[model samples]
Each structure stands twice: as C-alpha cells, then as structure tokens.
Target: MNNRILVTYASRAGSTAGVAEAIGKTLIGKGLQVDVLPMQDVKDLSPYRAVVAGSAIRGQKWLPEAMQFLSDHRSELSRKPFAAFMVCITLSMTNAGQYLEGLKSWMSPVRDLVHPVSEGYFAGALDFSKLPFSLNVLAMRFVVLIGVWKQGDHRDWSAIHAWAESLPSRLLQ
Candidate 1:
C-alpha cells in the first residue's frame, strides 16, 4: 500500500512550518513516508499518497498562497484523502465556544474546495519583529484586547504529535 504523504504548509513567521515539520517527523516515526515542504515548492502530488496541508492564519484567513494552492489542486485533492491544519495565536487562546465559531470562518473557504478528513488548530508563535511599525502597533492592540499572555512561541508539540499519529489510518484508509 502507498504510504507516501505530503505535509505541505504556508507559514508567515515560521510557526506553521514548525508544526508541519513535527507532523512529518511523527508520521515518519510511525513507518510512513513523509515529505515536508512549503506549498510553493511542491511540484507534484502524484508521488504522494495523501496530502496534509496547513497554513498560518492571517487576517482571519489562510494565506492567499495556501488558498490558491488548494484552488489549483482542488480536483486532485478531493479525489484523495486530504487534511488541513492552521496555526494562530488568538485562535488557540480563545475559549471552546469562540474557537468553533472562529474555525468555521477560517476553514469554510478551504472546505468549499476540498473536504479534509482531519483538521487541526494550533497556537503559533507571534513575532512582532517581523511586522512593520503600523501593523506591529495594531497587532499589539489586538493582543492586549484579546487578553493574550506575553507574545512568543506557544505551540504544543505533544498535541501536534498526537494528531500526526492519528493520521496514517485516516490517510491510508
């Protein structure tokens, strides 16, 4: 059986990439073949048996490039098993009720194109240094208003690993 899985991601400040890498590593440890790459670098899905795509949440949506990738490959993605994950600081910090509502808005667009068998939402790192002055000020205000703790990397590796461990069965079917 084909167990080759593509773990592709689009990250802004590198948090989603880290999660993708963790998922890929965990899948490999479970005796599956995995390839982790940025979405733009993935040339073909033919070599992959299944795909796990993720992106960093920006402005309440997946990055444009990530959405475009899904749009470009919607047919192929729908024909095979596909999974998606997102990394956002505010998303992970919100309560369960708000999380589901926020997830619907964030994941709705992608779901319209492809149906993912599995989905993940994770807290990503926040690096204000990467933002310009104007955006930085706005981000700070958003953080303060949201009542988030000190800004920094907040990813949960164990949760990521657990999610990865559960994928082989879903992906390989």
Candidate 2:
C-alpha cells in the first residue's frame, strides 16, 4: 500500500477543521493519497510518509491535544516531511505582521519541540453563535465595545490553497 499523507488538526468553533479539510482536498488533487483526521483520532504515524498538523489558537497556544499529539510522536515526525498551520482571528486584525510575531512567541512550545518543513498562518472565522455560552457574551460585548472584531469568515482560501500546492513537491521529494 502507498504511504498516505496525514493531515491532523485540532479545532474549536470549527474554523481550523475547515482549513484542515481544505489542505486534505488540495493534496488529493495533487494525486497523493491522504487522510484528514482530528488530532485526537490519530494514534500512529507509521503508515504516513508526511504530516500536516494545525490547530486553532486559544489564549495563544495550540490546543492541548494537538500539542500532545506532536510530543507523543516527536521521533516519528522528526524523520518525516512535516508541515504545520494555525488558525487565529488575530490574523485578521490590523498589523498582521506584528500579530504573527506575537503568535510565534505563543507557538514556542511547539516549535521548540518539533520543526516542520513549512508553516502557514491563516485568518480564522468568528461566529458568535458557535462560541461557548460564556465566551459568546464576552466576545459579542467586546466586539460591540471595541469595534475591532467583526463576526464572519476570514480565512484566505487562495493563500491556503497556494500553501498546500507547495507541499506535495516539498514533501514527496
């Protein structure tokens, strides 16, 4: 059997999951066998030749399960072609470059642990209805008060697709 490419992700409010799916579809279009699964569902890495992992950012960190997945498979990951991505509403804010700089600081725990051949930073969606009951109140009120955040989908599909298009060659080579 051909070694498949694994695309695993952790999502909250669903934006990151959509991004992961898009990555999986793009890879499939490139004629590579792929499997996209939630990070928690993946138990082994031996069947895959490459990996792409991502998570939604909350309080500036990858979700616990996503981080744990990487830590658990660090050895296997180090030997394979790997890539990572992140979804964050902060990326839609002004001064995105600075936001990314701060995001890097937040992602230190993961970076210090494993290195990916490439990394993607994409804007995320924000739907007040999807946020937890408590956060919904806070986020809605915060948006109304600060006028800094708007509720809508902000993912850049062109960028996401472009990034994914670059992966097969890099990984398969």
TM-score per prediction, in order, is: 0.89, 0.90
What does the lDDT read for residue 118 in candidate 1? 92
Q: Write the per-residue lDDT of candidate 2 for residues 25-134, one digit (tens) a residue.
A: 99999899999999889998899989999999876788888898999999989999889898988888777777677677766787888888888899999887787778
Best by TM-score: 2
User: In lDDT terms, how accurate is model 2?
Assistant: 0.87
Model 2, runs deviating above 4 Å: 1-3, 135-144
Write model 1 residue lDDT over 1-173, tens digit each, in one string. Answer: 37789999998778899999999999999998899999999877888889999999877799999999999988889988999998877655646446666566688999999999999888888777776667745867687667764577889899899999999899898
Candidate lDDT (C-alpha), each = 0.87, 0.87
CA lDDT of 99 in candidate 2?
Answer: 67
